[model samples]
Target chain A: MLKLQGIRAGYGRIEVLHGIECTVGDGEIVTVVGANGAGKSTLLKTVSGILGIWSGTIELGSTAIHKKSVERIASLGVVQIPEGRQLFGPLTVEENLELGGYAKRRSGRKAHAKLEEVYELFPRLRERRRQQAGTLSGGEQQMLAIGRALMAEPRVLLLDEPSMGLAPLIVKEIFTILGELNQRGLGMLLVEQDARLALSLAHRGLVLERGTVVLEDTGQALLNNPDVQAIYFGQHGGRRDSRTESA
Target chain B: MTFEQLLQYVASGLTNGSIYALTALGFTLIYNATDIINFAQGEFVMLGGLSAVSLHEAGAPLPVAFAGAVLTVTVVGILFELLAIRPLLRSGVLTQIIVTVGASLAFRTGALMIWGRDARPLPSFSGETPVRLLGATFNRQTIWVFGLTLVIVVALQLFYRRTLTGKAVRACSINPMAARLMGVSYSRVVLLSFAVSAAISAAGGVMITPASFMSYASGSLIGLKGFAAAILGGLGNPLGAVIGGLLLGIIEALSVGLLPGGSSGYKDGVAFLILVLVLFARPQGLMGGRIVDKA
Candidate 1:
């Protein structure tokens, strides 16, 4: 479980996250949907300790992590699959996955076990285990990014735009994987520009507008809300119109 | 020149090239980790040589002297990171690079104060008996240089490819932010890079001092050559650095042997010429595909 309270953070003097509060309960997938520059990535970066918060506290299961180093935060199991699928471009897919479990430095058997599990989840990765990450296609790269993060054996995964730049079919596959992982009880805080899919999969959803939470509701309720539909689902409830009507 | 004469030049070239390879390897480690061209890299080499000489003069056994010099210089590298690098980490890459230049000056002046201006010799690891190979004769130190450089390179390759820490370092070099998210400590990796880099350069310094007597000012030229070698091979690629070093050394030796009278005087200029040529023609070096991050 992860919690943030009145968190203020930014680049230099310009604040991006203005006293925002949020949480991801046990085995919960909390999706934050917002427009560009709405501080979604900043919130994740703050939680992962890549950026120091100006004020307020971030706690992972009651332990304060606001001032910890990025590595310390990660070792505490707050691993982030960064925006843009920032996999080690030159390293082999297996090497990238191996590095994911670096914090714990798992034993040979344990690491091998984790590797096997990840490969099972992404069989394409096993086939291309020796290939450099940069050479992978966009969908495969996204899979490798998720597979790499899972290698860390994280308790709470922070995903930033996992669907960005991914094709619709690939995004569907990714969301399916996320839903499957949540069913297995892996907590997640997902930031997405794909509001419909994120809400459909999320148990709870928050609409982030310019660094502030403008709305919070059950995913289905938010999906059916008039304002949410107007802004995110488009006036006529863009393609996949059937789902919007059903909601 | 006779074939034996050519063989002799290559043999000599290889001996010096081993030193350049070791020094360039140092540059690669630090450059890969921090993206800062540490000007003080040469200082570590000079420190290694001077410290070993002092220890030898003070009656420590040769092996003990060499090991002590490496340990001393490694500690200095760690201190430099903690005291100088850690403070300026947030100050941007250019500022940090400038600080290294300043550190080099400080190290040079300190060496001057401690050891003065005289060049000091480290007795060869083994007696200077000439070994013959195909009618070309070279000293035992040449064999030692080759053997040690080979050992260091093999050990380094194993480290990068086989060990978790080494992979973590490689990961850091590739993507520091991503590495951090994976729980790899960036600062610790940087520190390890500095320490290992200093130890390697120090070892090279200790080994080569017997052949080329070292003074307080010796680090500058050797460091420059090493940098040139790193650039020639591809700055981030370790194997490239070693090959570049050997090539540069051989070219310089060949130039001295074949060029007209007084050409030997320009032996040092050869590295710079190669350096400029590599930058203009193939900025990525021979092995690298593209410049990943620039300082």
Candidate 2:
């Protein structure tokens, strides 16, 4: 399980996440939905140790990891697939995946076995193994990003806007893979801009508003709530549209 | 030019080219990892030659002196990163470049203080037996320098392609954040790059010192030439640096050979001329891949 308690973090003096609290249990999918600048990306970055937490307790199981280095945090099984699919563009698909498994390189056979597992999850990547990562389509890059994270064999995966810029069909395929991975006992904290799609795939959902968690509930309940529908589902179309347009 | 004259020029050019290639390779390693153009790279070469000569004078075997020189310079490289470069990493590119320039001066001054101003002569690895090839004569040391360079280049290519740690270094070079997220230590990679860069440059120094006498003042000119080769080959590509070095050497040699009115004095100018031409025509270099802007 992964947990955050009263987490306060930001970039330099500008506080972006103000006392945010969240948790994702084993085999669960918890989604965060917010408009731009609601600290969605900031939250994930803090959790992953890329951004420092000003005050809070972050735990993976019984161990606190808030003060750990990024690589150490990753070695402890909390891996992040960042907002941009940060693939090494000039490297081949295989080389990217190989780097993803770098921490486990000493485990020779086990690492090789994990490589096979990743290839199995995204067979298209196997076929395009020799191609440079930059040449891949947007959807394929996202797949490679997720596959790269999976190579680390994370106990808890933190995903930031995995569906961004991807087509509807491709997004659905990606979410399905997330569901499959979750079913196999990996926990996920998914941050998404597409509220409806996130709610549909998540077991629970949190709505963040300007650096704070405004609402948290089961995904179905959040979907059914009149306030959520009004604020996030575009029922208040004029206000929501204007906000998105400005963003 | 006569064919024999051409062969002689080519052989000398290759020997000089291999030295530049080695120094440029050092530049490429550090540039790829930290994006810093280490001006002290040529100092590593100078130190290598002088230190080995001092050790040899102290009655150490040739291999021991060579190994000691490489090891000492490698330590200097790592310490340089820890003391000088790492602190200014977040201070942006201009500061980093200035710091390296300062470091180059410091290294040169230190070498002068320790080794004095006189040029030191090193005995060639094998006795200087000139071998005749295509009616042109070349020394055994030329063969050693070229052969060693070929070996190092091939070894480096294989290491990057076939080894996991080498791939991790490449990964850090390409995308440091992603590499960090994948449990690769960024500092370790940067440190390794420095060590490798210094060691390679030191090897170059050891190889070339016999042909060209070693002196504390030699680093500045050689370092600048190496930097030119790096830029000419596209800064981040190792193989490109090698090709650029060879090309620069050949161009300089040809200029000296063909130009009228005893143009040998203008040999050094020829390198910068090629550099200017390369910058104007194809700044990305002869073998440089497309430059990708990091996010």
For A84-184, candidate 2 gives per-residue lDDT tens digits of 88999989998899888777664678777887899999999999999999999999999999999988888999999998778879989998999899889
Which regions of candidate 2 deviate over 4 angstroms? A235-247, B289-295
Q: What DockQ results do all the predictions give, each relative to the true complex? A: 0.87, 0.84
Clashing pairs in 1: none
Q: Per-residue CA lDDT of candidate 2, range B133-188, in tens?
A: 77889988999999999999999999888898999899998889989999999999
TM-score for chain A, candidates 1 onward in order = 0.94, 0.94
Candidate 1 — what's its lDDT?
0.90
> Residue by residue across A159-206, what tens digits does model 1's lDDT show?
998987878889889989999999999999999877888899998999
Best by TM-score: 2
In order, the TM-score of chain B in each prediction is 0.97, 0.97
Tell me the deviation in Å of residue A90 in model 1: 0.3
